[model samples]
Every structure is written in structure tokens, then in C-alpha cells.
Target: MDTMKRLGGDAFAPQTTYLNSASTGLIPAAGVAAMHEGVQATAAGRPLDHFRDVEAARAAFARLAGVPARQVATGASVAVYAGLIAASLPDGAEVLLSEDDFSSLVNPFHSRPGLKVRTVALEDLADSVRPGTDLVAFSQVQSADGRIAAVDAVREAARAHGARTLVDASQSAGWLPLPQADFLVAVGFKWLMGPRGITYLVVPEDLGGLTPLLAGWVAGEQPWDSCYGPVAELAHSARRFDISPSLYSYAGAVAGFELLDHLGIAAVRAHDAALADRFRAGLAELGHTPVHAPGSAIVSVPGLGARQPQLSAAGIEVSDRAGNLRASFHLYNSSDDVDRLLHSLT
Candidate 1:
């Protein structure tokens, strides 16, 4: 409950002026330490202990996401997680998605044989739902514009048409409340403040029978059994999507979630919103217009190319997409960071 101790503020504070949690979160010292311990344990012939850490990490993430422990699965990357979602559907199933969704969410559908990808604008999503749609995948926050989607509405529309919902929470998982969906996937390196190579997917218990196409030994029903037979039956839980044990990265995620839980997601949300507001206000004052007038942690201001060189010269890190500059803020960011970014613009 002690927020400071639990969140590992000391470890994060000494790092770079890290405002880009949406890109890759700043890892806390605890996470680094945990990863080190996990690696050392693996080296000392105690690999089984690392598996314990992996399961513990999964349980911790499930608690933060308000799901049962078995409902959470870890993947090597967001793309892998999305692949699992795409594979759950029947071949050539029609997948409805947003035009503005992250490429990671769309590429899997393209790779699947017989899968048809349908794209729609964010605002027109409600009207686009049709009865034959098989899967609806979209991001809770648009990566380019940082516009928060009407996720609840989308979920309702998808359900009305008998479609399963797959939410890409890469940008909003730590900053906003996620709406209930049939499937949810997020990368730990983003808002969760964990290392890369770990992503999470949550699948509702009712749709648990969806076969995982990328089956692995670790995902087998009897993971501990050394006798290799036919690929063991895919697990009924979300763990079926996880192919192998990532004990080290999983330990880091556990440390990251511990910090997030200590801070309380409510506080994290408020902090990100306030910081984003400050950044938006500063950009407006500097004669820059944002793509989304009211933005979230990831704000995109137009005319980034004109301002990029100057900001880069000043050591201000920002992402330039097309003609917009993406400024992403996180829990560790303060009003000063916004001020510094604005000053670089001038």
C-alpha cells in the first residue's frame, strides 16, 4: 500500500527523463533486480524456480486486469498474441477492424488463410457491424491520433452481430479503464513498465474452446511431462496461447505489475491524463494544433517535422508520424517534462 516503495520510484527517478511509456516503459530497479535473480536462478540449476516466478507474474497481471489467473497468457510480443486471436476463428472468417488500428493488430489477420479483413473508421464502427462478422479487433486508443475509442459501444455492436471482440490495449492498458471484451491483448513493455518480449492476452472463459494454432510444448495440457507425445491437448485456459516459459521476462513483468498495483491504476490514470492535458495546453499555446483536440497520454501535434530538429537538438524525444509529432507521457512524467518539451518547440 505504500505507493513509493511498491512502485519503485527511486529506480525510475534516476533514469532518463522518460516520458514515452507508450513506446517502451521505463523499467524500475525492482524489475531489473528480479530479472537478474531469475537469470541467476536459471544458471544455478534452479530453472523450476523460475517457472514459479512466471506463474506468479501471470497471477499478478490477472489481478490488475480483474480476471482469473488462468485467463491470462503471456506471449513473446503483441504480434504473437494477436496471432493467437486470429487463429481462434474458423479459416477465412471475416475480421472487422478499424482502419486506424495498429499494424500489429491487422497483420495477423492478413497472414491467416481465408481470413477477410474489413476496415472501418473509428466513428463509423457502430454502424459497420454486420451479422456475418466473425472477429472485431481494434485498439482502445488509436496509436496515431491517440483518440480514445468508444470501446463499450464497439463491444455491444460486435456482440449484436455475433462477433468476438479483440481489444488491442497497447496504448491504454495502464492509463484508462478497459471495457470488457471477448479478448484483450497488451504488451508489457508499454504502459506496464516491464521489459519487452512479454505480452498478455485475456480470453473469456466461455470462448475457451477456441483452438490455439501456434501450439507449443509449454502450452500442452501436461506441461511438466517430459514424455513427448502428439502435441498435448491445448489448455482450456488462456495459457493455451503461451508457447514457452519466459521466466526472466515474466519475473520483470511481475515487478512491473507490483509497481503498478502499488500506485493504483486510478492514480496512474489521473496522472497520465493530467500530464497529457498539460502537454496539450502547452502545444496549443505554442501555435501547434493536435490531431485529436483532447488527447490521452499519446498526443499528436501537427507540424512535427518543422519542430523535430530543434527538439532533437534539445534532447527532447518525440515520435514523428506523417506530419504529426507524437508526445507520449506516463506516470513518471511531471508537469516539468511538459514544460521542457514546450520550451524545445520554441
Candidate 2:
């Protein structure tokens, strides 16, 4: 298929101008068809090996993340993986986090008693890493305003200080090239163009010192054999961290992953960023100064959040986050969508 047909022009048909991928991505036609097939199979009581879909999706995500399939753990939420990491930390271990990171990423550490959790400004996060900091955790992209973290700088800082790094790639995964970290977690619903209820965690080859807190039959060396009893042997790889698969969601995820694999992340990134840059230029022409996040696919205009409802009512999909009118572009979006939004704001 051609780029336009494969990416968005033909794969998606949104009634509204969808500029809210940061909120939730629109699953492509292939994903929707796969989901429909899954539902139909379930309704008909057909026997299908959904676990095959799970592993396929897992390997697909691993390819995007530049990791081996053995290092990826499939689950339903990023927070569950975050909690596992939290549970493995020793008491009073000092952790550094961004003040405004998504709560799922930050709250898990807080729930662990006796852990010292320190929050700092996003720009100051790398510098805040001190010798005693045991772990540094933050999102690769700020969900509120789409600020890309200085990942290389922060990772280098953590390495200098002997602090392990955890990055939440939920908002950045589909359109951004993920950096290596001790742990990385992402959900498929937002940018991977997959259904909700599927998330992934990339752990180090040694599993990043995390306990499989939510391990179930799926985490077994032989999942079917491990069911109805204690797992005789846990998976030797990161599969040990897997939660029971959500079969239907995994079906859709497999399709979404296939779509992304065919399109390629670098191509998607360039497409998304270009549209975002177009919107920024349009916003500038309209005399609106957006939040300073150069080269991000998400554009947030300060003090214009109140217009979100107005835009929505006018058939433009966007988000009002932390008092900013946030618009996120994706592989499926185009210059026309950017102009439509700009025209509405005018």
C-alpha cells in the first residue's frame, strides 16, 4: 500500500478533525477489523490461539523499542509494571522523578513505604540526580504539554550517579525512538493506534531486579502446564513479568503493530512532527504563543484551554490539559487538519 493509504488518509475516517492523539489514538482500519474478528470468534465460541497474538504483538513492540522479544513483558497497564519495579526497591531507596509526570508513573513509588521519592522540574531532573539517588524515573514525553525529556542527558547523569533509569514511553512510543533505560513502559492505546488494555514493559536482560508481582499463568515457563497450580518454573526471560493476556486486546494490538511495522517509526515520527510544525506555524500566524516544546508532535497553546469545548463542539478533536489547549498530531494527520484547527481557533 502507498504511504498515504497505509498511514491515515484511507486507513482512518474520523468524523471530527482528530488532533488529540496525545489523549487517545484512532485505531486504524486493520486494527478495527482485527478487533471485530476477535469479538466474532468469541461470540461463536471458536477456538483460536490468542496467545500467539500476544507473543506476536510483544515481539512487534520489541522491534520498535530496539529490544529483543525476551526482554519485553506484556501486560494491561503501565502502572502494574511500575508497581513491580516499586516493590523490588529496597527500603529508603532514593528515587528521582519529574514533578508533573503522569501519576501512574509517580504514584507507584510513593505507595512503597520508606522509599524516598523526590520530584523536580522536568528541566532540572537530570541535574537533580545525586550520588545517593538509587533510581531516576520520568516520562520520555510530558503528557500535559508534550515536552520531550533530555533523555540522553538524564541517562548519562543517572549513569554518572549509579542510578538506574525508568522511562514511561506511553506518550512517545509510537512516534519517538525510545532510548535505552533500566526499565521502559508504554501503553498501546495512545500512539500505537491499538486498543486499550494492552501495555508493554521493557526490562534489562536480567529483568531489571523487578519481582513479578502480578505474575500469573502467563508468566510460567509453560503457561498451560503452570495453570491450576504453583508455577513449577517461572519464565527465564521477561515473560516472567507477564500478566494474563487480554486476548481480544492483543488481537487488535497485533494488527496495530503490523501497521506500524509496515509504516516504520522513523517515517511516522517525521510525518507527525511535520504536521505539528505546520500547526505551530499556523498558531503563530494567529497570534497564539504555544508552550515551548520544539520538535514535538504535540502542541499546547497556553491559556487557550477554555476553547477546547468550543473546538469540540465545532467538530475538532483536541484536549484541554493543565489549562493548555493541547493538539497532538500523528501519522494519520495532515496539513489540512492543521489548517482546519487553525481556522476554527480564528
Candidate 3:
């Protein structure tokens, strides 16, 4: 199926050429139906229907990550999993993070009583790892500049020092190849095109005896049976870290996962890259030189921050942050979107 033709691509309709998948994705028609079904089920007192969708969504994300279903857990948001990760680390351990990375990872460790937070340049992480560092955390892709981090190298360096790693994959998951890390968290709202409030937390099975940070009924060896027991043993899998998403959100994520599964993650990635390349080339031809970081699907138009309103006035949608007019690409975007953006600039 032509990706654009699939999922009722014309759903965007008479106006609004969406080019902001980095900020939020346009949910597909099937996804909307799934969400509606979930909502109706909940309304009819069948809220438990969410677990099946949640399980299916977890499996889909597992396939995307090239991991097993046992390593995937549903969460409410990135911050929730970040906090759990922070709490699981050994007390007084030092954590290294990039200076410009998102704060969700940092704020969690900052609140931990004895943990030490260290800042280093994103490019220097691989060189900065040391024996005493217990954890290293950073984004798989930088949200601001859309730079794909040297995360695998960072992971290797951390492992060489016997330290674990956490990768916030919020910007790269669903549409990009996932990095190998000790932990990863991705929100479903962006590239996955699911409803907001659904997040997937990935932790390998070999991570043993992690002290549960946000232990709940579902985080037990047996949720329904272990209720109110004396801090029951955490489940042997990553599901132990789950902060289960609501029924509606779970249904939406499942729908999004199904769409990605149907289209193939690699195909979506190639499409996004092609569109991003076109955007950069077109802007450059129009005298708008783009700042690019290798392997990222974001086109950075410098000095676009001030002209964002004008671009929007001309019916273009993108994020303007600081000095950058950041336009992200996905399967839904087309050549016309880039052309319109260039024409608006001219």
C-alpha cells in the first residue's frame, strides 16, 4: 500500500499540511476507531479490555526495538520511567548526562538524595565514562537540534566501566532503529502517532534484582494475588517497571503499533529520511541553508524562529525553537509540503 494512500492520508483535508511529527503525530483512522472502542468499553464498565491492547502494543514495540515482549512495559509518560530508573540506581552513584538533553532524566536523579549528577557535552560522553560512574543517560536523538546521539558508543563506554545506561528514545522510537542500551523510554504520541499519555519503557531481562521504584499491584510477581503483600517480588521482566497506561491510551497505542507493523518500521524510516533530505535541499536552494546533524530526520532552518508566524500564516506547520525553524518529516509528509515551505520562505 502507498503509505500516504493508506490510513486515509487525505484526512488532513482542505488545509494544514502537517510537518510536525516530531512534536505530535496525526493519529490514523484505524487508531481513532481503536481509541473510540476503548472509550466505549470503559463507558460500559469493561475497562479491563485495555490489558489485551496493552499486551499487543508492548509486543509491537518489542518488535520495533528488536527485543522480546518481556522487556517492554507500558507507562504513563517518559518522566515516570525516568524516575523509576533514577530510583533503581545504587545510592550515591554518579550519573553522566549531556548538558542539552531533556530534563526528565536529570530531574529524577537530582531529586534522589545521594545521587550525583554530572554534565558533559553530548559528543564527549564516550570519553567521559569512568569506573565509578554507575549510570549514563542521554537521548538516542536530541529533541532540540534533532541530532542522533552517538549512543551506541556511549553504551559501550559505559559497559566498559561496568555502568548501566539509559536512553530516552522519545525522539527516535517507532520511526528509527532503537539503540542498544540498558534502558530506554519512548512516548507513543510522536512518531508512533498514538494518543498522548502512553509511554513504553524497555529494560532487558538480564537486569537483575532492581529495587522497584514505583511498585504497585501490577508490579508484583502476581498482581491480583499479591495485592497488599509485603513488597512482593518484582516481576522477572521489564513489565515490573510498568506504570500501566489508561484504557483509552493503551487502545490508541495498540492501533498506532498495528499501523506501523503494517507499513514496516524500516519503510517509514526511509520515507522520513527521503522527505527530510528533500526539505534540506529545497531550503538550501532557496537561500535558506539548513543545519543538519547526520542521521536525523529534522531540517533546521536557522532564523526561522521569528518567521514561524509568517510560515503558519502561509499554511505551513513546523516548530520554531530559539533560532531554528525545525521541520520534522514522517511518512505522511509529501514533496508538496517541502515545496510550500520553500515558497513561503521565498
Candidate 4:
């Protein structure tokens, strides 16, 4: 069987057309099974090591994110991780951001008082980093239109300016090879093909000077021993920053990560991007120009958002964002899916 089919064919119905991975990924059958087993174990009150699943998922995410397991902190959402980073910053610190970046990545900084938040065009992100910039935060692959950031340029600028970096990979992980950042957060639902309520945060070796604002018993050096009292000693690593894991969510995430490991990100990226490129070409022939995002797996066409309902009624799945019709191709999507959408648009 083809690799994509081997990984995800049984996850969808025979004629299901899902092109909205940028919105939410279809959880593979393996993930659903794992989650079911977790629930069963819970119902039976059987001794199951839920934390073991969390560790397994965390380690898998660490490998995919190219960071040490000790550097990864399991969380529930990007907003919480962003809040952690926001709390770590000194008052009046200058933060640079992309104006059109996802709200979860943008809103946290605004919520923090006395921080100088500057927003610029996504294309101007690297150039906007100045000497006074304490941190530069943006999404790796933009959710609104799938425009990939110039990560290297931004990293270089941040380094030259002695600034830290925060990258939200919710729209890019599992397919794109992510660059290292001082802080990175990715939700498991989108692109990672896991259930919701699972998020991963990669912090620096020194824990990025972040306070464990939401630390619970899990953040203890010895979690079981520290229950019912303040943690005797916080975890020495980024584990200190961990929020309690959603057990069943981690179970599903571990399965999702296993599939991703077997498929490999490079292969997935090629598969997804090819379908996206095919759709882009067909859009040109149909006289519908999409957002220009070279080498991205998302195709967003402006002024056609009204057609989303028509497409959905015809059993197509896509997103309409800010008056643009967005279609995100994942590993499971094929050229046939691309052509089908193009035909519907015609």
C-alpha cells in the first residue's frame, strides 16, 4: 500500500473529502483505538500508567521537534504556553510579532501589561527586529493562509539583536522540519493528527527563565510524593513547566506520534506540498489566484469564501478565513482530492 494509505487510509470513510487540516487533522484509527483503550482502563479502575503515555508522547514530540526530552513541557494549549512566556518577560520588554499571526500567538502578549508589543507584516518580521527587541514571536507556518515564515532570517536577526524567539508550529509540525527556537509550542490536534487537549512546549536549557505559573502536582520532582502539598522541589528541567496531562489525549497523541515516526516528516511534507501545488496550478487555470506561498501545503483563494457552503454541500471540506477559501493538504490527501476541489470550484 502507499505510505499515506498505510498510515491513514482506514481513518476516513470511503468517499470522505477532508482538506481542512489547517483547521483540525483527522485522528488516525490507531489514535482512536488508543484513546478507547485508555477510557476502558479508566472505567475498569485498572492500574494504568497514564503518565507513561505522557512521557512517551513527550519524548516523541521532542524527537520530532529536534529538542531534548528534558526540554519539552507537555501542556493543554498554545495560549497557556504563550502566557507562560509572557509572564517570564520583564515589564516594558519589547516584543515583535506578525500583525496577522494567529490570535493565540498574538493575544497573550497584549494581555501582559507594560510590554511593548510591535506588529509588522509577516514579510517584514526579520527586518523589524531591533536592538531593543527582547523577544520575537510568530507562527512557523501561518494558519490564516499557510505562508511559511523565513525562519532562518528571523533566527539570524534575533541572534544578532540578542533577542529570544517563540515559534508556534501548530500549523506546521508533523510535516515541516521545524527550526530551533528559544520557545516553541505546537498543539497536537492540527497536522499532528492527535486528539485535542494535548500541546507541547520546547523551552531553552535554562527553562527560558520562565516561572511555572500553572504548575500542578505533575511539575514536582517527585509528582506522587508531592501530592497534597507544594512541590518539594520543582523539576530541574522544562518538566517543571508542565501542566497536568489530559491522559486519554496523551494516549491518542502517542499513537499519532508513532504513525508520524514511521512515515517521517520529509516524506509527509513532499506528499502534502505536491497536492497543494497541483491545486494552485488548477486555481490559476480557473482564474482564481490563491495566496502566494511557495513550498507550502495550504492554498487560500481570496473572494471565494462564499463558495465554501456550496463546496461543503457537495461533500468537500475546507475553511473560509477572512473572505478567503482555504484548503490545506495533508499526508493523506492526494492529487485526486486536489482535482476534485478544482472541479467543484469550476
**What is the C-alpha lDDT profile of model 1 across 1-346, one tens digit per residue?**
3221223357575334455666788777888988888778778977546677678778877776788989888787778877767776787689988885788988988888878888989887878989889888889898877888888888898889888788888888776776688888888788888888877888887645566776677777677762386665766677777857666777777777787777778888777777788788887788878877364778888767467555666677667666777888776677777888888777
Poorest lDDT segment (10 consecutive residues) of candidate 2:
1-10
By lDDT: ranked, best first: 2, 4, 3, 1
Q: Candidate 3 on 202-221: residue-level lDDT in tens? A: 88787544656676877776
Provide the lDDT at 196 for model 2.
Answer: 89
User: How does candidate 3 score on lDDT?
Assistant: 0.79
Alpha-carbon deviation at 26 in model 1, angstroms: 0.4
Pairing residues by index, what is the TM-score of model 4?
Answer: 0.97
lDDT of 4 by residue, 1-346 (tens): 3533323556644356889999988888888888898889888988468789999988999999888899999999999999889988999999999978999888999999989999999999999999899999999999889899998899999999999999999999988998889999999998998899988999988888888989888999888887887888999989998888889888888777887888789888878887888888899999888998999988889999889898999989999998999999887786677888999988
Q: Each candidate's lDDT (Cα)?
A: 0.76, 0.88, 0.79, 0.88
Count clashing residue pairs per candidate: 1, 0, 0, 0
> Cα miss at 39, model 4 (Å)?
1.1
- Superior by TM-score: candidate 1 or candidate 4: 4
What are the models' TM-scores?
A: 0.91, 0.97, 0.91, 0.97
Clash pairs detected, candidate 1: 92-114
Residue pairs with clashing backbones, model 3: none
Residue-level error in angstroms, candidate 4, position 282: 0.6
Report per-prediction Cα RMSD to one decimal.
2.9, 1.7, 2.5, 1.6
